[model samples]
Target chain A: MTNTILVLESVVLVLLTVLVAGLLRSHAEILRRLHALGAGLDPDAPTSELASMPVELRSRVSGSFATAADLDGAGLRDDALHVAVVGTRHRTLLAFLSSGCLTCQTFWTAFGEPARLDLPDDIRVVVVTKDASEESVSALRKLAPPNVSVVMSSTAWSDYSVPGSPYFALVDGGAGRVTGEGTGAHWDQVKNLLRQAADDASDDSREVRIDRELREHGIAPGDPSLYRTAEQIAQESRA
Target chain B: MTTTLAAHGLAIGLPTGWEGRIQRRAVSVAAEQTHAVVHLANFALPEERDDFGGGVTPLMRSADVFVVLFEYGPDAVGKPLFATQGIPRVTADMFGSKRLQRPLPGQLGCQRFFTAHGRPFCLYVVAGSRAYLPRILAEVNGVLTDLDVAP
Candidate 1:
């Protein structure tokens, strides 16, 4: 009977050892999973697993234009060339030109053909030229399109930060922000800038709409998990 | 969500459900000192209060993405685009020792350098998972494209 009892004790010890080993292995597996998940969230974690991934070059400036500063001055189109840029419903394009500058003549020549300007209806193009003699004004008047507004202001060059003649700036009058600004050396370049600004404005509104959707779902802007997906766990595991 | 780093003359569009903060640090290279602005965004995790004896260890301050803008002097003209030599292999040095190099495959997110109005700038983006990388990159590209650098 003692032998049988000893055998039974040995069997129990073997069984206990196996169970403990199994438990340890299971615990290790759990720890490994936790580690993987933690690493996924770590920005410093090495991404060697992704070394073979393809690199894509995407345009950063597509449909975007440089931000413009607020134009500081007063008054709308009257006898004076200065127009009140601060409060207006339509977007304003301040074309800074001078009657004396040769480059301004080229810009004015381009401006003569309104159809060629290809500006959207919403953009109210205003010619801001330096005060000139009657002769210069008459020359400029012949070049100015009938639909475009023409004004004369000596302060515009300094106020608009136009380093020289043949410069242009697009102002979103509602926001009082410069949407675009550059030298009007090429009419195509000016047109591209305007298109880019309009595209950027639309893109901004789209982003706002997306932000609203996230807010409705109780997610705020800057939430890192905003783009998290159910498949992310699988992707992390593969990595 | 979108916020502007007005001091750096930058505007960034943050992913929805994320939170962001800006920290500015002064850095110097070869006696030329400049400011580096870091826009850090992270997951909006709920606060976990420690109730037991285990000390309250702060959650790791790891972020999903970091947008770093190196501010140069107005007179600083960026090196030509063709001068791609010696682009720092490690990003830790750019932000100082505090940051880490969490590069994507081929260092895609951390590789490129940019210039605006003659000011040199670099961007680094990190994603929690490969699945989110493409979208994050696209968004980052948008921000960089529309970036307004003060001249």
Candidate 2:
């Protein structure tokens, strides 16, 4: 009886070990595939890192790249110019989306509706889709918002290094640089991101004004008076 | 900062606050290489615009700048109208409201026909405000410096 029990125990142990090994291999393979698809495991990583990321907002690497890719129309015969994202007088919002994504539907509907965006500011919005090869043109045509420009450019996807759908990039045409970019599942979440970008811009302008005033008062960088401790600042303020 | 937009061997550099695109229109699944159109502007461009800014120019605000680079058949190259060897350096005086495709108020338009890089092309520009013509033309010229011909 004892010998039989030992054999049975060994068999069970072996089976368990094999199962664990198989599971580990499967997990590793899944991660590898995700990585291959440009999906980043970390939220703090670059925009493309989290390709098709969850419906959450993440502040991206500010000024990650100096310029954005110019958008060329993919499968459309319309007279739309290959839209440029840089060097514009006003702001432009590039929405990277797909026709089939369930998460993207909310956005399409929101943008397609005749109602205003009620966005943080007045901005030109453009929808970009992968080449017709990867996306369904018929579905897109049905979903294409009358208010926004839809361009089917696979090159634009690779050029922008977009990892997944439902991504947003705000381009300051005057500066011709990406002021803000990230992924959002819905318009409400995306709207907050735009608001945050606007706040950051406002903050930057305020800082610039403060710095100019200080310089006008003859206080430059590394000035001793600027390095005063909190106590000194409090005392001066009190005075 | 400036970004370069190139396609079909034609390239142009866009300066800060200037956005534009290059395209060879596709009739079906296959893209057509003929009649490439390049549009550059210093204002927000609407998606519904025609090659000549049908939906966009009407929305231009004061001080906006729009440039259109319309490509023609290679046969159009070296014609008297396109006799210029390279993209002509646009001067301020070359612009006037009369040159506009439509007589829009407070706008000035300039058109130049030239050949560059073995291709025939027309360079069209519209100034949103006539008072800012010289300054806007200067900005347009700054960007045109990077214009490339075929290949």
* lDDT by residue for model 2 (B1-151), tens: 3567666667777765566667666555454446788888876666656777787778887788889889888678678999887878788888888998866889888999988878888899888987777788788888787787773
After superposition, the stretches of candidate 1 with alpha carbons farther than 4 Å from their true spots are: A1-78, A133-135, A222-224, A227-230, A233-239, B1-151
- Highest TM-score: which candidate? 2
- Put down candidate 1 lDDT per residue, A1-239, tens digits, no spaces: 99999999999999999999999999878755543422233446553322222222112255343333322221121121123354345577888876666546657777667787788866767777666632276666576765555666565666666666677788876676677776634567677777766787788899999999899998987787767787996798899
Candidate 2 lDDT, tens digit per residue, A142-231?
A: 998766878888888887778888788887877766777777755766777778778888888999999999999999989999889999
Pairs that clash in candidate 2: A40-A49, A74-A152, A84-B20, A87-B17, A87-B18, A87-B19, A88-B17, A89-B42
What DockQ does each prediction reach against the true complex?
0.01, 0.22
Instruction: Report every candidate's CA lDDT.
Output: 0.51, 0.76
Docking class of 2: incorrect
